[model samples]
Target: MTVIVRDFRPEDADAVSRVRRAALPFEVTTPRSVLFHVESANPAGKYRLLIAEMDGEIVGTAQVGVAYESGTPGQSYANPQVHPGRRGQGAGGLLLRTAEEHLAAEGAVEVYAWVLDEPEFRAFAERRGYRPTRSAHFQRLDLAGGTLPELPARLPPGVELRTAADYTADPRPMFQADAEVTSDEPSDIGAELDDYEDWLAHTWNNPLLDLGLSTVVLVDGEVAAFTAAHTDGERRYWSGMTGTLRAHRGHGLAKLAKTDSLRRARAAGCTDAFTSNDAENGPMLAINKWFGYEVCATEVRHVRTFG
Candidate 1:
């Protein structure tokens, strides 16, 4: 059997989602989300969803794109995921090579990817000149059976909980809040959210985002913090982001938003909840632990620079 890498076709969405879910079960992905990502990617990103096909079957998928939001120019990423059952078949190498070529053609001088922290995965990246920079953990919570902390009887003075749906008429406040909080996230690449229209196309209107389950904390009618939620519309749910504005950092508003969102998810019949955080994010890690989440897997962000 021979494996070849090629651009993703419109009909490959389901197979791509299956490969991603099989490779990273802790993450939420759907056919519609895959297609939306490909269709909505900004041209500046030079994004390409590549598929590794063996015969007529798609055994691996990779997302290649320049990180246009990063503080540095020409920084790019090519994250490839091969089905666990299909590894050691040369598909990974082909996918990586194809992605690198495409990114180089697009004028990327530095490339980055996430590799599972396990021995073989790390070895594969290291052999190809990728160096480990930062690590993150994928945490999971049992929403169907495990115990969850009871909601506080009283919120802080003048604070209220609201859902993203409440802002259907106007989502500018929530977008602003997201922009502020995201700019402060820990990363090798510092992103500054400057385009509201881009955010609307790529985030607010994404197919995986669950507006009803996403919760926000309001301080005197102003957006203070929020926990964005995404679901597969059945059993699995994921926390897209949980952040608190600088002014409201000490009031536990982030936790409040997340807890409210999780409760809503459980009530909606989602059996499993998942989230990920950078290794150095002590506060968010502690909050997840407090919510009874356990580390299910770990991944290291690998960087490869072209000289």
Candidate 2:
């Protein structure tokens, strides 16, 4: 059977979510979140969701987009995921090729993708001229039964624990904090979060983001640290970001924020928690480890520059 890659349709959300869950069990995604991503993508992103179908069955999918938020232009990304059992049947190659073509047409001079840190996965990217750049680990925590660190019984003097929902009236402060935090995050590609409106549309409004579960550490009324929580509307929770502003670092604020968020998520019916961290991010990784999050999987960030 021949594998044909085509644009994603609205009805493909469920199937796409199924594939994603199967291919990356440590990640949290729902059909609603899937649709939200397509509906809310920034125009400058030039995003495309493509599917690979063979014999009327979708075997693979790709997320292609220009890094519109990048400080440097010509940076793009395409992540293709084929069902584990369906690989080697040409679905992955077809999906990647389709994504590359779309990205190149959008003026992308380089493309980045994450390949599972496995022999076959690495070979696939290398064979196609992609080289490994950095690596990240997917970590999972069993929130239903495993014990999480106890939250501080009382605030530390001027410290207060607040949920992101507490700032519903004006989220500009949250937006600004997120921008500063993202700029300091470890990554091969840097992002500039200058557009408050764009962040409001794509990040704050994302359906998967659980504002009630997101924890913010307020030091004397300023946003010192925060951790974003994403859920699948039920039992799965993911930590989107655990950021401590520059001046607030070295105070164990990141750990405090994550602890607060994780406790909130488990109490809200989330049985599992997942998060990823670049290998070089020792502080965050150590915080997650202290929470008993085990390494579930590792993916190598691979890149290819176009001449």
Give lDDT per model, in order: 0.94, 0.93
User: Which stretches of model 1 miss by more than 4 angstroms?
Assistant: none
TM-score for candidate 2: 0.98
Q: What digit string (tens of lDDT, one per residue) describes model 1 on residues 1-307?
A: 9999999999999999999999999999999999999999999899999999998899999999999988899899999999999999999999999999999998999999999999999999999999999999999999999888778998878999999999988989989999998998889877878898999999999988999999989999999999999999889999999999999898889889988999999999999999999999999999999999999999999999986
- Candidate 2: 10-residue stretch with minimal lDDT: 148-157
lDDT of 2 by residue, 1-307 (tens): 9999999899999999999999999998888888889999888999999999989998889999999999888999999999888999999999999899889898999999999999999999999999999999999999999998887787788899999999889999899999999998889789999999999999999898899999999999999999999999889999998898898899988889988898888888999999999999999899899889999999999999987
Q: Candidate 2, clashing residue pairs?
A: none
State each model's C-alpha RMSD to the native.
0.8, 0.9
Candidate 1: minimum summed lDDT over ten consecutive residues — where?
147-156
TM-score of each: 0.99, 0.98
lDDT of 2 at 76: 97
